[model samples]
Target: MTTATETLLPGTDIVLEQLPKVSLHDHLDGGLRPQTIIDLAAGIGLELPASTAEELGAWFAEKSNSGSLVEYLKTFDITTAVMQTAEGLRRVAHEFVLDLAADGVIWGEIRWAPEQHQQKGLSLDEAVEAVQAGLDDGVAEARADGRTIRVGQLISAMRHADRGLEIAELAVRHRHAGVVGFDIAGAEAGFPAGRMRDAFDHLAQSFFPATVHAGEADGLDSIRGALLDGRALRLGHGVRLAEDIEISTENGTSYARLGELAEWIKDRRICLETSPSSNLQTGAIAQWGDEMVDHPLDLFYQLGFLVTVNTDNRLMSGTTLSRELALVSDAFGYDLDDVLTLQLNAASAAFLSVDDRETLTDAIIAGFEPFLDAEDAR
Candidate 1:
C-alpha cells in the first residue's frame, strides 16, 4: 500500500488504486502469496529459497529483476511445486481473487497451464475443477466482504508440451462452469502457435475465445503464428509487434509506416496485453530500451492500436493492476482519461459475451464516475 504522500499518478490527486480495473493477463501460478507458498510447501515437504514470507517475496523480486528470463521463470518452479494438490490449487485461486479485489480489480482472468499441476496424481479435469471451486468461493467471499468482483479461468496449454488439444477440450468442457477462454503459455521462441493448430482449430470451430502468449519472449513471426494459426482473440504481451512498424521524423514531426501485419492489428483492434514491469523484467522490451519510457506501449497506443494494461505476473513483478497503470502513466505522462481508456480497452477485450462486456463497461464507468466527478470539483 502506498502512503497518501506518495503520488501514484503525477500531477493528479487521483489514487490509481481506487479505480475500477480489469486484469486480462495475470497468471495463477505466478501470483501466489509468499506466506501461502511457505505453508503449502511445508505440507508438501518441498524446500523453499527463503524462510519467511517477507524474505520469500523479496527473493522472487530479486530473481525477477536479475534481467534473465531463465531466472525470472525459475521463481515459478517454487510456486508450482506447492500447487500439486487440489487443496493447494483451490486455496491459491481463492486468495488470488481476494488480492485482486483489494486492488480494485472488478474482473480478472487467471491463466495457468493445467498440465504442470498434475504431479500429485490429480487429472487435468480435477485440477480445473479445484481451481473453479476456489474461484467460486472467492467470488462469494468477496460479495460477503462487500467487494464485487468476478474471475474466470483461461486454461493455458504449455507450448512445449503436446497437450494442447486436451487442454482446449478441458476449457470448453468447463465453459459453463467457470472457464471463459483458452490460452497457450510457456516458451514462445521455438514452440510457435502452429504446433497447437489442432487445438486452435478445435477452439475456432467451437467459437471459444483464445489468447496467445507471443511477441514477448519471441519476435514478429511468433506473433504471426499466434494470429494465423492460433486464431487468438488477443495477444498476451504483444509488445514486440512494434517491430513491424517503421518510424521516421521530419521537422520535429513523426510518422509511422505500418506494415501489413501491424496495419491489420491496429485496424482490426486486436488487443495487446502489455505488462510494463514484467515486460522489463523478462527483457521483453530490451530492444527498445532498458527503461519503461522506451516501451513500445506508448507508441502502440498513440498509433491507435488496441492496448490494454496488465500485470502479467504479479508476484514476480511485485505489482498490481493499479501499480502497472501507475507505472505506465508515470512513464508516459498519462492522465485519468488515459488510464480509463486502458481500462476500457481491457473490458472490451475480455472473453465474456458482448452483453456481459457491455455490463462490465457500464460497471467500470459507474465506478469511475464518482472519482472523476470528485477530481472535477477540485
Candidate 2:
C-alpha cells in the first residue's frame, strides 16, 4: 500500500473507518484499485494515462469530475479491459470487497455487467464463478479480520445491448451461488427498461428483485418504465423523481403535490438509492442545479420515499458510503439519527428474506445506537 498523508475516513477522532454502513449501489469494476488497474494494464499491454498509482488516481478523479457522464464512463474502459480473465475477475472482486470492508461497509451489492467482461472468451457461467470465488474469499478474509461483511452480486445487463434476457437467466441460474438480484445498467436515456422486457419478465417469473437505473440520465418516462415494465423494487439514483413533486407555500405554510409516479414510489415505499456527489458529477441532477442543496433528496426523504444514501462507484466517484452520508448530512442538514434512519431504510430494502431483513434492521439499529445517543444528548 502506498503511504499517504491521510487515511480516507469520515472523522479522525472517532475511528470513522469502523462505523457501520451498508452499500447498495457500489460497482465491482468501478471500485478497482488504481494500482491493480495499472499493473493489469501493463500485463495486458494496455497503456494508461499515468504510471504511478496516485497519478492515475488523480487522473481518474479529474477526468470523472468533468460534469459529463460520458466522460466519466470512459474511465471504466481501462477497468473492464483488465477484468475479462478469471484471475483478474476474481482478484478484482476480492479487492473490491476488502476495500468496502475497510470503508466500514457491513454489506454491499456489487453490480457489474457480465456481457462487458466476455472479451477473454469466458462464458457467462465462468464469469459468475470467478466473481463468486472472489466474493467468497473476501467474505472469509473479512471474517478472519474480525469483521463480518457480506456482499451479493446484482447481476446487471446492459440496457443498450440485447443480452438482457440471457443475463437475467444467468442471474437466476446463479441465485444459489452468489447472485442476489438483477439490474439493467448503461445508456439510460433512449434505452428504457421496456427495451429489456424479456429480461425483466424472466426475472419476475423467477421472483427476483430488480433495481433499475432511472431518473438520472433520463426523466420521468425512464422511471415509469423501470416501475411499470421493469417492476423494479428499488430505483438506482431516482433523484430526478423529485421533478414530479410540486412545491408551494401559501400564507406562510408549505405543502407539496406528488404526481402519479412519485405518488406510487412514495406510497409503495420504493427505495431511492441517491448518490449525491456522483449525481452532480454525472449531470444526473444537472437539471436541478449544480449544488448538492439543489438535490431533491431532502424532499423525497421528507415525503417518505425509502431514501438510502449510496456511493455509486467508490473509485470512480472517489467516495465511500460514510462520505456519501457525510455529504448528504452536510447538504441536507441530517443528524446522526437521520444517518441511522438511512441505514435502517437500506436494511429494510435489502433483497433478503423478511426474517433476514428484520435481522439486518436490528443489527443496523444496534450498530447505530451510539450515534443515536450522541445526537440525542446534543
Candidate 3:
C-alpha cells in the first residue's frame, strides 16, 4: 500500500499523496522527465539548453516563467524534437503514465499532437499506435506494482495548422484503440476554434468528445469561440473565462455577477480545467492578480462553475496532481470535502463512457473513505 508520507498537506496532518486523482489536461510532451530528455536528445544528437538533468529541469522552469505564451511554448520545441520517432513516443508515453501513477493519479487523459511527431517519417496512425502500446505497458507495469491506473489519449490538432479535419478523423478512427477525445492545441491567442468549423462539425456528426484549449492565452472571446465553434465538452485551462464575471460587494457581502457567456457555462456545467501554477507563470490571471490566492479558482468553485484542478505542464511548473491540490487547498482554505468535490467534478467531466465514469467515481469514493473516516474520527 502507498502511504501518504510522500506529500504532507500544508498546515494539516493529511497525507494527500495517498488520495486518488484524475488528470484531464496534461500534455504528453510537457511531462517528460529531464533525464528522459537528456537520453533522447543524445540519441537524436540534439543540443540542449542545459547539459545535466537538474540544470535542464531548472531551465524549463525559468523559460516557462517568462510570462509570454510564445516564449513558454518554446520549451516544447526541445521536448518535441526528440519525440519524433516511434521509440521516442512510446518511451515518453510509457513514462508519462508511470509518473502519473507515482503522483497518485488513478486516471488521466494524455493529449498530444500526432502531426507534430510526423517529422521522423512516422504516419499519424503509427504515432498513435506507438503511444497506445506504451500506455498499455505503463498500465501493466503500474498494476504489477499494485497501483491501479487507466489512461486515454486525447489526439490533438495544432490550432495554428490546417489539419483539424484530418486530426478529427484520425481521433475518431482510433476511438476503439485508446483515443477517447479530440482537442485543438497550440498558439491559442490568434487561432480561434472557429477556423476549424468543418472539423468541429464532423466531430459533432461523429458524436466524439472534444476539449478545446481556450481562455489561457486569450480572453473571453477565445472562450466563446471554443464553445460556439468547437462545441467543446470541456475547456482546456479556461481560467480566463473569469474575466467575463463582475464581482461586487453590498453591505459587506461579496457577490459575483456573471455575463451571458459565464452564466451559460456555469448553468451548463461546462468543466473549466484550471491549472493554478501554470496560469500564474503564463499570466493567464494577470488582470486579477499575480498570486495563487488571487486566482479565480475559488471564485469559480464558489460560483458553481464546474472547476477542476490540473497540472498543465508538470515538468515546466515543477508540480504534480497532489501538489496542485495541496497548493489550492492551502490558498483557499479548503477542507477535505472541498477537495473531494473537486475530484468528483473531474470524474464527472472525464471523457469516458457513462459506465466507466461511474466505476471511476466508485473507486474515488472507495479510496477517499478511509481518509474521510480518519478525519471524522479526529
lDDT of 1 at 11: 72
Residue-wise C-alpha lDDT for candidate 1, range 290-369, written one tens digit per residue:
99999999999999899999998999998888888888888899888888889899999999999999999999999889
lDDT of 3 by residue, 1-378 (tens): 335337666666777778898999999999999999999999989999999999999999999998777888989999999899999999999999999998889999999999999898999999999999999999999999999899999999999999999999999999999999999999998899999999999999999999999999999999999999999989999988988899899999998889999999999999999999999998888988998999999999999889999998999998898989989999999988888999999999999989999999999999989888988898
- Winner by TM-score between candidate 3 and candidate 2: 3
Error of 1 at 116 (Å): 0.6
Candidate 1 local lDDT, residue 305: 90
Poorest stretch of ten by lDDT in candidate 1: 1-10
RMSD of each: 1.5, 2.4, 1.6
- Per-residue lDDT of 281-303 in model 2, one digit per residue for the tens? 89888877999898888888887
| Best candidate, lDDT | 3
**Each model's TM-score?**
0.97, 0.95, 0.98
Error of 2 at 311 (Å): 0.7
